[model samples]
Target: MARVLEVQGVSKRFLGLKALQGVTLHLEEGEILAVIGPNGAGKSTLLNVISGLLRPDAGRVLFLGRDVTPLPPEARTHLGLGRAFQIPTPLPELTVRENLLVGALFGRPGRSRKEAEAMVEAVLELTGLAAKAEAPAGELTLLEDKRLELARALATGPKVLLLDEVMAGLRPKEAQEAVDLVRRIRDAGVSVLFIEHLMPVVRALADRVVVLDYGEVIAEGPYEQVAREERVREAYLGRRA
Candidate 1:
């Protein structure tokens, strides 16, 4: 598949500190790329820059072969990029159906109310939220909340989905389910770029892994290859010897 998102030599600065330094990466159409890094590695910063939440001090972002680094967040969303937050936040007072409606209304490919509702209903079912549509958003369990967050992002009609730590707070079984949901998202033809700390989940879900440490890519490859790298293991975990 062709490249759907390209980030080249991206950098960001705060005060005198650099959060990212000449980071470059991209995602292929319908591929799942797992990004793993220790804290403060600028993983989230990279995601933000690609999604248009943070502007890069240097470099450019291209979406489907077009420069989009100058575009706003909403414009990116409108152009088939969507993201779920690391922390889940839904409208507590809104019913699952109603909250989903908001995503559908704002993120759908439609220009009218009827189109929005139809799109929302389709995604609600796809994300397994249809059964709980009438349930209040505040009434959901942790896993359910995570799924809802993903569902909302999908409702925005994104072809490239950026997921940050969706499996962070779930139980092992719940984590598996969340992983399954992401697989479904990819199977539906959307590309996935996920940031995660769980080694097993990354091993299971990612076609390839990208390792970041102190804001630079230390390694990139299949899970086993990366996990076996001496320097990568040392960077993430102190060497046994």
Candidate 2:
């Protein structure tokens, strides 16, 4: 598969605090690349930079061979880039289906509302939310909310999905279900770059892993290679990687 997302020599700073330092990474099309790092390791910062929520101080972001460092999040989304948050955000005033409709409408770059609605229905079923189509978005359970977040992003019809710790704070079974959902998403040919602290999930779902520490990539490769790296083990033990 071709490279779908690329971060080269990326750096970000806030006043005197350096949030990221020369961070470079790439996400291939239709692959799951799990990013694991301890607190203060700039994992979330990387996501924000890629999604255009935060501008990096230096370096470039390329999508489909196009320079997108300056593009806004919506522009990127229109080009098949999508992101999910640690906390799912849904419109309390809207029905679950309505929320999905919004995604469907936006997912297609220049598609019509009717087309978006048709697409939304398909996405709802894929995200396992078809049964709650008429339910109020505000009434969803935690699992449903997380699924909704993913559903919203999927509604954008992305080829690449950036997830930020969406698996945290769940029971073992719930976590397993969430992991299964992610795998299913990947199976549908959407590349995933997920920021997760849970090693088991990372091990189970990711074909590759990227380990970051102090804003720089400390290790990158297959799960076993990265998990067994001395530096990775040290980094994990250093700040709980």
Model 1, 1-241: lDDT tens per residue?
7999888998899888788888888899999999988877889999999999999999999998999999998889988898998987899999988887787777745548777788789888887888899999999988889988888888888899999998997899888888888898899999999999899899999999988877788899999999999879887775225
Model 2 over residues 62-155: C-alpha lDDT tens digits? 9888999999888999998889988888898899999988887876677888888887888887878999999999999988888888889988
| Candidate 2: stretches off by over 4 Å | none
Tell me the lDDT of model 1 at 74.
88
* Model 1 quality (TM-score): 0.95
For every model in order, what is the number of clashing pairs? 0, 1
RMSD of each: 1.8, 1.4
